[model samples]
Target: MKNNLYNFTDKSGSFISFSAHRIKSLYLPLCNEILMSSITADLHGDIKSGQNSFLMEPASRADLSLSKSSRNFWVYVNKDQVWSAAGVSKNI
Candidate 1:
């Protein structure tokens, strides 16, 4: 089956959309809470390399998590709130 796609939109209205193929066994520092892993996604309808995944650290570390089943997910973050929707096929 094809992997599900994830979309992230920041407060500035910019978007970074992608899908994770295989979650890395090792984690790289993204911030105090989040880490980097190997994944791939489409940027402007073009498939990106596996090295293109970066998880942003949320204000509350407990607000987010990632795993193999994390597909068709939408994440919206701002200074006040962190919102996410899973198993949905829509864009912000």
Candidate 2:
């Protein structure tokens, strides 16, 4: 089965999209949380690489946790919300 495609949008009406293959190549174990973290890291790296600020706004609570690492920037959607993480990636 083909992996799901993910889209990232900024507040300035600009957006970039990526396929699961692209994500997998960058980050091992393409699980949802890992993918989200990968996306945030990639985005942050892109911004830092360009010497610009990185900003992310996840549409849902599930998408927000990827940025939780101390190495990454974290922006939570809500304090009382919770989400069950999905399956782990089998292909390492």
The TM-scores of all predictions, comma-separated, are: 0.16, 0.20
**Candidate 2's residue-wise lDDT over 1-92, tens digit each?**
63246443677755454553344224322234223223332332111112132343422323433443323333333675433222222321
**For residue 68, what is the lDDT in candidate 2?**
38
Q: What would the per-residue lDDT of candidate 1 be over residues 7-82, giving only the tens digit for each residue?
A: 5467774544353524323222233233333222211111112235423322121222333333344455666554
Clashing pairs in 2: none
TM-score (C-alpha) between model 2 and the true structure: 0.20
> Candidate 2: where are CA atoms >4 Å away?
1-15, 20-22, 27-70, 82-92
Q: Give the total clashing residue pairs for model 1.
A: 0
Provide the clashing-pair count of each candidate structure: 0, 0
> lDDT of all predictions, in order shown?
0.33, 0.34
TM-score quality measure for candidate 1: 0.16
